[model samples]
Target: MEDEVVAEKTNRQVVEDEVAAEKTKRQALDSALRCLIQGQGGELPPNVAVGMNSLEGQSRKDGNT
Candidate 1:
C-alpha cells in the first residue's frame, strides 16, 4: 500500500536524522577534548566543564560512568 511505503520512508528518515545528530555531537565532543588538551590544565570557565560533562553523559548508553 502507498501508506505503508510512506510510513516506512518516514521511519527511515527519522533514523537517518538521529544518526546525523549523533555524529555531529561526537564531532563537537572531540573538538572540545582537543581544545582542553591543548589548554594544558589552565583554568576554564566553570560552564566549560559543565558543558563537557553534560555532553559526555548525553549518550543513550550511559557510558559516562
Candidate 2:
C-alpha cells in the first residue's frame, strides 16, 4: 500500500539520478574530445589545457610512450 508507493518513488528517483549522472558523464567526454581536437591545432579551453598539459607531462615522464 503506502510502502509500495514509497518503494516506487524511490525506484523512480534512483533512475532519474542515474540518467543525470550518465548525461553529465557524456557531456564531459564530449567536451574533452572537443578540447583534444582544438589542442591539435594549438588551441584549447583553459581548463582542458591544464589537463592536457598534465597528461603530456606524465607521458613524457613515462618515456614518451
Candidate 3:
C-alpha cells in the first residue's frame, strides 16, 4: 500500500511538472511571436492576429490569464 501511494504521488508530480513545462513553452512561443510582430512595425498580420485571438480565447477558457 505504501508503494502504491508513493507511485501515485510520483505520477501526479510528473503530470504537474509536464503542465508547468508546457506553460513555459507557451509563454516562450507567445513572446517570440510578439517580437516577430513588433519587428514588422507593431502590427500583427490579420491571419496571425486572428489565430492569436483564438488562442487567447482558448487560454482564457482553460483558466489561464
Candidate 4:
C-alpha cells in the first residue's frame, strides 16, 4: 500500500513537471514569435508560412486536423 502510494505520488509529480515545462516552452515561443511579428513592420517573415504549413500538414496527417 505504501509503495503504491509512493508510486502514484511520483507519477503525479512527473506529470506536473511536464505540464509546467510545456507551459514555459509555449510562453517563450509565443514571446519570440510576437517579437518577430511586431518587428517585421507589416510583413511576415518568409519562413513563417512555410513553418506553419509544415506543422499543419503534420497535424493533418496525424488526424488532428
Candidate 5:
C-alpha cells in the first residue's frame, strides 16, 4: 500500500538522519581533540582530555560533568 511505502521511507529517513548526526558529532569531537592537542603542543594522545581527572572530578562536583 501507499501508506506502507511512506512509512518505510520515513523510517529510512530517520535512520539516515541519525547516521548523519553521528558523523557530525564525531567530526566535532575530532576538531575539539585537535584543538586540545595543538593548544597543549601536541604532547598528549587523543583522549587525554578524558584522563584529566581533577577537572573531571571538579565538574562532577559542580554538576557540570
Candidate 6:
C-alpha cells in the first residue's frame, strides 16, 4: 500500500542521514589528527594549538574569558 511505500522511504532516508553524519564525524577526526601531527614541532602538537585557539575564541565570543 501507499503507507508501506512511505514507511520504506522514511527508513531509507534515516539510513542516509546516519551515513552522512558518520562521514562528517570521520572527516573532523581526520582533520584534527592532521593538525595534531603538524603541531608536534613544539611542546604541543599543531592540532592542540589549533584546538586551544578555537576554544579561546569561542570563550571570548561567549564572554566567558
Cα lDDT of all candidates, in order? 0.72, 0.72, 0.84, 0.70, 0.67, 0.69
Error of 6 at 26 (Å): 0.3
Best by the TM-score measure: 3
Q: Candidate 2, after superposition: displacement of residue 65 in Å?
A: 37
Instruction: Assess the local accuracy of residue 41 in candidate 4 as a C-alpha lDDT between 0 and 100.
Output: 67
- The lDDT leader among the candidates is 3
Q: What digit string (tens of lDDT, one per residue) describes model 4 on residues 13-61?
A: 9998886676567556755775788788665566875775575576456
Number of colliding residue pairs in each model: 0, 0, 0, 0, 0, 4
lDDT of 2 by residue, 1-65 (tens): 99999999999999988866765675577578877787789666799769856765764574542
For model 5, residues 22-55, the per-residue Cα lDDT tens digits are: 6567556756876787898865553565565444
The local lDDT score (0 to 100) that residue 6 gets in candidate 1 is: 100
Which of the predicted structures, 5 or 6, would earn the higher lDDT when compared with the native?
6
Q: Worst 10-residue stretch by lDDT in candidate 2? A: 56-65
Per-candidate TM equals 0.61, 0.63, 0.69, 0.63, 0.64, 0.62
How many clashes in candidate 4? Answer: 0
Model 3: ten consecutive residues of lowest lDDT: 56-65
RMSD of each: 4.2, 9.5, 2.1, 5.2, 9.6, 8.4
Tens digit per residue, CA lDDT, model 6, 1-65: 99999999999999988866765675577567667766885355567668866855764674444
Q: Clash pairs of candidate 6? A: 35-47, 36-47, 39-45, 39-46
Question: How far in Å is the alpha carbon of 17 misplaced in model 2?
Answer: 0.1
The whole-model C-alpha lDDT of candidate 4 against the native structure comes to: 0.70
lDDT score for residue 48 of model 5? 62
lDDT by residue (1-65, candidate 3, tens digit) is: 99999999999999988977887688689879998889888888799889887877876787776
Whichever of 2 and 3 has more lDDT, that candidate is 3
- lDDT-best of 2 and 5: 2
